[model samples]
Target: MAIVELLNQDMKQAMKARDKETLSVIRMVKASMQNEAIKLQKDALSEEEELTVLARELKQRKDSLHEFEEAGREDLVSKLNTEIEIIQAYMPEQLSDEELETIVVQTIEEVQAQSKKDMGKVMSALMPKVKGKAEGSRVNQLVQKNLS
Candidate 1:
């Protein structure tokens, strides 16, 4: 099923189960998706578009988690972690380190990225393939590791 359909179904399930946290997180995601769709002047988002929004939400949660931990805010960190888990459930499986390494190597070769100066070329070549499957920082680290 498309992401929107799946999210709708899961929302219903969360409501029925009285999963307050899950329901709230899913509702936030749905709202964000709808808001983005409106901003784009579209009736609905495509699956790829939905994934992009979801990815941004996940990244935001990750950044919050880091800040919460650094501030010694265990209560907020725990809450954020729960929300992160719920958000991630909607994302595609993350790429393994080995798989990411392989892709970075291939991208480097494809883009003829011989030095750090060609980082943009390698990143442009890799982003489409890695989108929704891996984090940008992970991809950048792998590319740097392979290129240097």
Candidate 2:
């Protein structure tokens, strides 16, 4: 099923099951997807486009969780972590370190990234291949490690 259809079905199930956390997270995802469609002047987004939005939302929550922990806000940290869990359910399986390393190596070679100066090109070339399957920060770190 398409993401929108899956989301609608899940939303109904959440409602029937009285799953407040899941319902809220799914609602947020729906709103974000709709907003992105509007921004791009499209009536509906493809699954890949929806995944891009979902990935970004999940990243924001992860970032917030990090900040909450750093600030010693344990209560908010727990809440954000729960939110992240709910959001992550819709994302693709994340890449393992080994897999990420392989992709980075291939991207560096494909982009002819011989030095740090070519890091941007290497990253640009790799992002599409790894998108929704790997974290951006992880990809950046892997690329930097390879380039150096």
Candidate lDDT values, in order: 0.93, 0.91
What is the model-wide C-alpha lDDT for candidate 1?
0.93
Error of 1 at 54 (Å): 0.7
Best by lDDT: 1
Query: Per-residue alpha-carbon lDDT of model 1 for 1-105, expressed as tens digits?
Result: 889899899999999999999999999999999999999999989888999999999999999999999999999999999999999999999999999898889
Q: Tens digit of lDDT per residue, candidate 2, span 22-137?
A: 99989999999999999999999988899999998988898888999999999999888888988887888999999999999998988889889998899889999988999889
lDDT of 1 at 86: 91
Candidate 1 off by > 4 Å? none
* lDDT measured at residue 57 in model 1 versus the true structure, 0 to 100: 97
